[model samples]
Target: MMRPIYLLLGLILSLAGLRAQNLTAPLLSGSWQSTYHNPAMVHFLPQPVTLGLPGLANDLRLENLQYKDIFVEEGGRRILDFTAWSDLVDEQNTVQDVYSFETFGLAVQRGRLGLSLYHRLRVEGEAQYSRTLVDLIALGNAPFIGQTVELAPQGEVVSFHEVGLGLSYALTDKIAVGGRVKYLVGTSGVQLAEGGSIQLRTAEESFALTLEQDVRVNTVNALEYERLDSFTLDYDPTRLSFSELTGANTGLAFDFGIAVNLDRLRLNASVVDLGASIDWTEDVSSFRFTGTETFDGLDLLEDLLRDTISLATAVDSLLLTYEPERSTAGFQSQIGASVYLGGEYDITERLTAGAMLVLEDRLGELQPAVALLGRYAVADWLQVGINLNHRTGIRTNLGLHLYASPGRVRVFASSDKFFTLLSTGNTALAGVRLGLSLALGQRAAERPGRSRSSFASLP
Candidate 1:
């Protein structure tokens, strides 16, 4: 029905406005959250024993679109403004939304050896669409008569739970290495298969439109399909259960990192979420549509508006013309993977500067990002830093990070795009990371050979 289609569109727009993972979290010196990006960072944390409680250590990123793209001021009031959006959007845009939560986590260190265990929940979604699709939605086929409008919008949603174990060791005073192995359980997923395309061509004379489409919706524990003794019914996504979000498939993943400390300079590198895949076998379903049809634009619109023909009936007619199919079969999905390299130089006892390069694979494309960072230790218990970033399609972004330790308790937070928080217009990307944990260990000043173990004292 039209209601479901509208709901899906609203959900996509909301999800597209957010993104995930804190690229700056790993730069914190004494926080256990740093180990998330580079496990070797455990060697630099001041805590010998750390406990991360639930609802903490959260990271989210939303990119590609902003507030100004969706709303505009009209008659002194803000209103949904698709015209404003059309003016800002490009021919092709990709939206990414990701969120992660660390439910329960712990890390312990003994001499040169460190160990960690944690459970996490992660949700990721992405959408790629052409401007023509938006134009068709907002302006309708009348304005697009005599031309072909390509509709190739595609996206996927995935949710999974992970249990991970990490090990780190100092091979030498100047070198440390670490790796994490994770078991992944997929809870729910929806993806669009390849060979899917759509085109709408409207004739100038009669205003008749020809619709051609080939779409496949694959699901894992996110839909229900029935096959009776005599007849088989199509899958119903609306009947999915909440238990699907707990997990319906299984897989494995790993992260590897290494750090080098020398004089006033330090270097670190990591490969994260590497080679992760989930196999959806239980309750899997695939629904497909492949056909071409012609309709008088005016008649179709009038019937849709007057309720002469139900939306479901019209869709059914289209599918019946093509002999739509459904299948219950297992399939595989890969996780988004990333690599990071960073270096820092100590300019003074309380001041340091660094640079980082992040290479991430998204939608079959490699996106490279660079950030220049500066941090100052205001006190033994307080550290703050700022980052200036540059990436494709994004010219500049200012980010901030803060870490405070008060009475053996550590609190850390960071954002990659802080400008979005200051403006009411949806014109920029934004993200935030926050965490709280208890630290138990000898003070940095009381430890023996503190200079040899401290990154700030490398010189």
Candidate 2:
């Protein structure tokens, strides 16, 4: 049937020309739970009782956001729309490995003063396709009519489903701070066009083949789709099946924190999540553009003037080229930090062993990693733990935590970049983080039969 309508109009004009050469580039900031730690999980919180205002405290932490094999050895692609045609093809760039979201949080204390509530959820799937074979010249230097072919583009499929919320405060007990406000609801995708079909072979005698089509299709009614997860626009499977592009000017993000504790030997430092940015104006009530022209022996060619004034000048030249209405009011920014050290010397008298050393910093040029936590207690409810995190190209996370009896049900497991390794340049993400925590009403009356000598003689 006309070669599947010219291969579906050359795969929708090479997915609108690789989304206009990947909207230019430069936009991959940071901040997404800092990959792990300081997520307020506070070592799986549940040990604070001085309500009578002695050390002042109120905290809550729940963990479960496992990440597969994060950065799978720089293997496992994720987003490379086009490194500007990477020198014609040596091949590299196109991966959006999806799998994110499964978070919940809440923290409140009143001694050193503290308050927190954070939530992040995501659902993304990506796909990439490429094909190139272009070489066309002479548009003003007559060389030999009928011999020019071009179709420089490959393939793509982007999907991002989202949900986020944040709030944090901590002025003491080691310094604390926070901020968050995000909503990306959902988004769908499909993009394939860089150089898929362009054939031109000439031996003269009566040859004829000329092609230099630069198709155009633009749409960027931003609601925040490139910073802190922002994507919406569904239904378009040849007539509709990816419609859900939500917008009404919803985009604003922020976060900051700093924690520290050094009791003469044991240590702890913090600069938890810190991200704030927004710039995505909305106004793209459905765009349109389609082109097709085939000729081999003449069956009827020649019909110019594509549609909708070249799709509104390709969405106003891709919003003036990558959110350029003067830097879209605010480009992108994110920061992260964490450092910890633990101590405890005792092998008898009920047994005890502890160890901790962690260092981290994301967004600021990327590159920083170190994690190791260990603990063991034989009796009195039993306790055992171990956690190791490493990043030298991402990937390397091991975990195991078990605290039975009176510990209000604690069990954990990990291995697979723990939380999809973050920083040092994200490469999609791996997955796994199952969790459950419940200790209602004043933390179940301070568990452990609540009797530290009858509340230590009623305070």
Candidate 3:
């Protein structure tokens, strides 16, 4: 039990090293990747043909906690300490980790019409809890004696592969609209519903406790089910093979966006990952506990504080008092959704400024963020920009973006929190976004003496 907990914590810490969506990608006007943020931007691609190979584009975000919360300096050394870390946790907290990678991408444009297709893999996980739960594990329930430690914990993990088709067209010279349809193949998932809690109260010279738990774990592969079964029988999970790839779940989703061009100003808006849900129907299992039991005259508190007994031993003894029922059932999980709105102004022939607003839903809560941007076009082959952003519960962060269309190949990269790269200490946020692609056909905005009017037409 301690090993699994440690492994989970290690995984979370490692994932925290990478962070959120490409909030600055849309500002790279000529790059094909811009379409990912606002599909309508496809109409603004400088090249007529674009092909992105596997591992070219990636985005990740951490919704809760930060580097400092997971990695801390103790006694002149930095280490992963959950017990020390629990002191920084809020009374109510939610942790969300999302990762998306483009496996294959392509885009083609002719005059006012544009088309795109891409394959991607996305994994998202979220956990919500009350601080009391953390204290139960980090400091033990000795401090909350005689009080009900209300525990309402919920979490879910889902991974799926997606194939998306997008289409965009210019309506006159000022407006363009686009939409994408995505087909998803779910590979794995686990969800915890609301039905568990623990209450510990200390009596005169002993401790009394009540426990209740109800949870469900789901997966696409039958081997995962066998692994859980093996754990219940022999407490050995290493025998489980987790490399199998099988499609046992499926779903559909869509994205809609529009961009408007007006003289020296451009406005854009889009809603992505809307109406996405996964249904787990294969290799499903559910466990539920609904009875109450009390322990009397047990020196559980002293043993817990003194390390005289292991937490697993204490839990196993309690479980023998009342066991939970295990069964099989199907369940559904929803994907995180987001909305983006942006505007940009051409201050000069070689300079532009912009602002964007983003609203993302995580764990049934809406998280809002804003960014201010400045870009300089050094040449037809090079462009650079900086973004200053602020998101709820996070400190202001700076980001950098570079788009280089050197010869027939294009390369681009952006990070929402670039300053973290130079920090020797821990950061509150971190992220990286980059991609490489081959481009061909006439350069749409590269004609000699073409006025800035054409270059500023869309953003």
Top candidate (lDDT): 1
The residue ranges of model 2 lying beyond 4 angstroms of the native Cα positions read 1-116, 119-207, 210-218, 222-282, 294-459
lDDT of 2 by residue, 156-239 (tens): 332232233434343444334444444442232333223344333332444343332332222333222342122233323212
lDDT digits (tens) for residues 327-382 of candidate 1: 88888878878898987777877787888888988777889978888888888778
Question: For model 3, what is the error of residue 190's alpha carbon versus the real structure, in angstroms, after optimal superposition?
Answer: 2.4
Cα RMSD for candidates in order: 5.9, 18.2, 5.4
Measured against the true structure, the TM-scores of the candidates, in listed sequence, are 0.82, 0.27, 0.81
Q: Which parts of model 3 are misplaced by more than 4 Å? A: 1-20, 55-65, 72-79, 194-205, 219-246, 296-324, 424-429, 447-459
Ranking by TM-score: 1, 3, 2
Candidate 1 regions with alpha-carbon error over 4 angstroms: 1-11, 16-19, 55-64, 72-80, 221-248, 298-324, 424-429, 446-459
Candidate 2 local Cα displacement, residue 398, angstroms = 18
User: How would you encode candidate 3's per-residue C-alpha lDDT over 331-444 as one tens digit per residue?
Assistant: 787887899998778788777888889998877778897889988878977778888988775667788877777787777777777877557332224456677788777655
Sliding window of 10 residues with minimal summed lDDT for model 2:
20-29
Better of 1 and 2 by lDDT: 1
